[model samples]
Target: MEGMTDAPESQKRALRAELRERRRIRTASEREREGTALTQHLIDLTSDLGARSIAAYLSLPEEPGTRDFVEWACENGIRVLIPVSRADGLLDWAPYDGSDEDEDLLGMPTPTSELLGPIAINSVDLIVVPAASVDRTGMRLGWGRGYFDKTLGSMENCPPVYAVIFDDELVDSVPSERHDQRVDGVVTPSGIVAF
Candidate 1:
């Protein structure tokens, strides 16, 4: 059993190195194309699931895609939530309603809405997460802030976690520390990837 665990860890480290190298070579145009495709894929997934309430993340510089899923969710009457980071490295969710104006939080654009309040993780039916990279086993590599890890740890019966990544960023493994949270699914430019 110990050997089994070590094998995955070893593979994950190797995959992480490979992906980092690939990302270093990606151009601006390539990122744009991947982002558009990923956005569309997420929209399709949300529609298919008929998710009435979802908690999604605001994208960062390296992650591909826009918040079209949030807009679509609002139009379809599905409540959307985005994480608001606290100083202690935990995520507090705020509801997202469609609005042209958004608030800038930690350099990310967050939707402006009246649905601001404390959200119980169990109350959310679905969750869309942002990732720098993801592996086949649904493990995600974030910006290394440990924010999502701490937040997810607090949940007893949380919603399904979906990591959104560019197609090229999806690999067979990713280097995961003991504190890293494993996502339940991955949404890339091509399609939905389930571990």
Candidate 2:
């Protein structure tokens, strides 16, 4: 991750608030267009990498949506695993059936199917995570929760992990700590960028 954070937790909170507001102000059409482009970029990347199984997240309203990409992956015989947040800050995985019928946890949609436990991430070839922002150095700023940080750290030999964000969310720097696992790359509407 980025060497000791230049900003404190309070600054991180302020940045998150500003980014969330900007995301919330976007029109539905703009979000849809960006989501579509993002899906295409991801599809191309996965195809290039020959990935069969991917661990992904169900995006929130203000975050770049992944439902379309998840459905497309399933239709094309790619296994898609989604996360279910646990009270202890760990993630439980479940196969995505391309259904929007899910419950909200901490304001984000989660699968209600039989959980496959957190280790399920170990079997996936790639991981697609949600991030509020990421730095050029690959440090990810999550929604103040350490779920992904914990999950990624626990993986045996974790596959290539990627964070999905909007075009503007990819920046020059973000506050990150030692425990925060850095991603291999980021996927935005414009294209994918690796650190």
Candidate 3:
């Protein structure tokens, strides 16, 4: 029964590999179309939550794109805080510059502004995070990196956290552990659902 309850690490690795392959094969046009829809989903969500300040990410080409939503937030006068990678494997925050030119080494687009430090995440009204996959229980599987995990765990007065992923990335279950923080909801190209 214990074996049936949680997937082994091997199973999770295999699922990650499969999903990576799928993302690799997806075309740019397809990703753009999906991004457009996802932008709307995020917009509606921000409205319903009355989020004036949002913590979100700049996506890679393969990930569910959040550039549109980030730009929208900036245009609409919503304070947008993006992450900067830190040497300690934690993330620091910076305001989005609403530019198409800035990016970090990992191909993750970033802002070229003064970093507001890690604790700045606590000030946001909502969080939109990237995920390799998320289960029905809102368990997010990251790329074996504990950055988001640490971020979510450290917040004392945390806001609602949502994992942003492509449509098929939301699955039945993902391997879970004591340190893995669950999200409040998920945002896909199709729609949104809270866990």
Candidate 4:
């Protein structure tokens, strides 16, 4: 019975490896085109949701881009908060007020502004996250990182959380564990997919 508990996690690891390879091989021009489409979709989502404040991530090069959308949101007076990882496995957020950038504990790019406690996420009307893949049911598969799962699980009054991915990453099924959390929807280069 105990061995059963490891099955999903092992399956997730293998799947993540495959997804990472796929993303890593995308051409730069293709990524740029996808980024443009993704930016428009994110803008539309925030507009539709009437979200004045949003929590989002700084995308890595291989991931679907979020920088253009973040830039647009800040320029338009919409508040944006980027996550900073803590050693305790919780996320602290910082306002991205068109400020300079710094690396978070995990070395991800974050804002250089003052840090806000973990609960700061509650104030956001929308949250956009990065994912290796998200299933049709909204189950997100990250790169073996539990940070997002922990954050989403601990939220008591979480707003709409969405994952950013390319269209192909939206799979029919993904391995899930008891601790894995689901997003409310996904934003792909194709469009927004609501679960």
Candidate 5:
């Protein structure tokens, strides 16, 4: 039983290491191709869901595919909330209206205009998370940061969690610890996978 328990953990660590190496070699063209595919998949996933309020990440330069989803969400009548960094490594969310130019916020690109309204995480109907990698079971490896995990932990009746990743980045498994938060779904270039 002890060995059985350790096996998964060992596998997770190895997987994480492998993914990190792969990401290091990923080219811009690859990211752009995958981003285009993933954006289309996301559009298909939420097009008819009737979601009123959504929480989504503002993509960085390395993750350039997020703008499409943001534009789609705004056009579809979903109120979009994006995370703003606070002093305590905590995130406070504000609405994203999609018209503002990009500004640097907490090392990530965010909207420059004050077009957001404050809201709690639990109030969101859906959440789209950024991931370094994801697996079939919906586990995600973030950028070695626990911000999303801690934020999700504080919510009750939280909406479904979806990890957004490029198609090639989706693997069969990933490294996860006890503090890791598992997603309910994964959005890839191919499709939305529900776990």
Candidate 6:
């Protein structure tokens, strides 16, 4: 993990807003192409890592798309687990069966399948997460929520944790704190960056 952040929370928030706005203005065709490239990269990562079961998330409309990858994993007999946000500032893991889903308390997409304990993620071979931005050193700036931070921080022998973002979101630096967890690498439309 990276050291204590050189940037403050306010700085982080401002950057997140700018990034989100940039994503919001992308043309539909652009997003589709990026999502396709992103799906291939994710599939390559899983294949390279030889993962049998993985933890991943459903992408939001403006985020780098993981939906296609998640669905593909389900169809390929890969045991996929998705996150369910809990009121306690932690996450619950649920088996992703390619079933209709529900949004969590935070309005993020979540599975309605049978829920597992938080540590259920421990068994997965890999964990793919969402991020607003990630720095060159692997420090991730999540979207204002500590959910991924807490989940990753609490892991015992956590697998290779990778964040999904657009290629440009890979920047020189991002505002991070002591609580922020650095990822093993990141997957983007252009390719994967293993930090």
Against the true structure, what is each candidate's TM-score?
A: 0.78, 0.92, 0.91, 0.97, 0.80, 0.96
CA-lDDT, candidates in order: 0.73, 0.87, 0.88, 0.93, 0.75, 0.93
RMSD of each candidate relative to the true structure: 4.3, 3.0, 2.8, 0.9, 3.9, 3.0
Highest TM-score model number: 4
lDDT of 3: 0.88
What digit string (tens of lDDT, one per residue) describes model 2 on residues 156-191?
899999999998999999877778889999999999
Relative to the true structure, candidate 5 reaches a TM of 0.80
lDDT (C-alpha) at residue 58 in model 4: 87
Output the TM-score of candidate 2: 0.92
Query: Candidate 1 vs candidate 2: which has greater TM-score?
Result: 2
Report residue 53 deviation for candidate 1 (angstroms): 0.4
lDDT of 6 by residue, 57-155 (tens): 999898999999999999999999999999999999999989989999989898888999899999999999999999999999998889999999998
Error of 2 at 182 (Å): 0.6
Give the clash count for model 6.
0
Task: Encode model 4's per-residue lDDT on 80-132: one tens digit a residue.
Answer: 99999999989999999776998987889999999999999999999999898
RMSD of 1: 4.3
Among residues 3 or more apart in sequence or in different chains, the pairs in candidate 2 whose N, CA or C atoms overlap within 3 Å are: none
Question: How accurate locally is residue 141 in candidate 2, as Cα lDDT from 0 to 100?
Answer: 90
Give one digit per residue, the lDDT tens place, for model 1 in 34-153: 877887888877777777888886665555665666777788898777777656666666677766446544656675654354444558778887776877888788766777777776
Choose 5 or 6, whichever is better by TM-score: 6
Expressed as tens digits, the lDDT of each residue in 21-115 for candidate 5 is 77667798888788888888777666646568888987866663778888888887888888776657677776788876554446665656454
Query: What's the CA error at residue 33 for candidate 6, in Å?
Result: 0.6
Which is better, 2 or 5, measured by lDDT?
2
Of candidate 6, the 10-residue stretch with the lowest lDDT total is: 1-10
Error of 3 at 9 (Å): 3.4
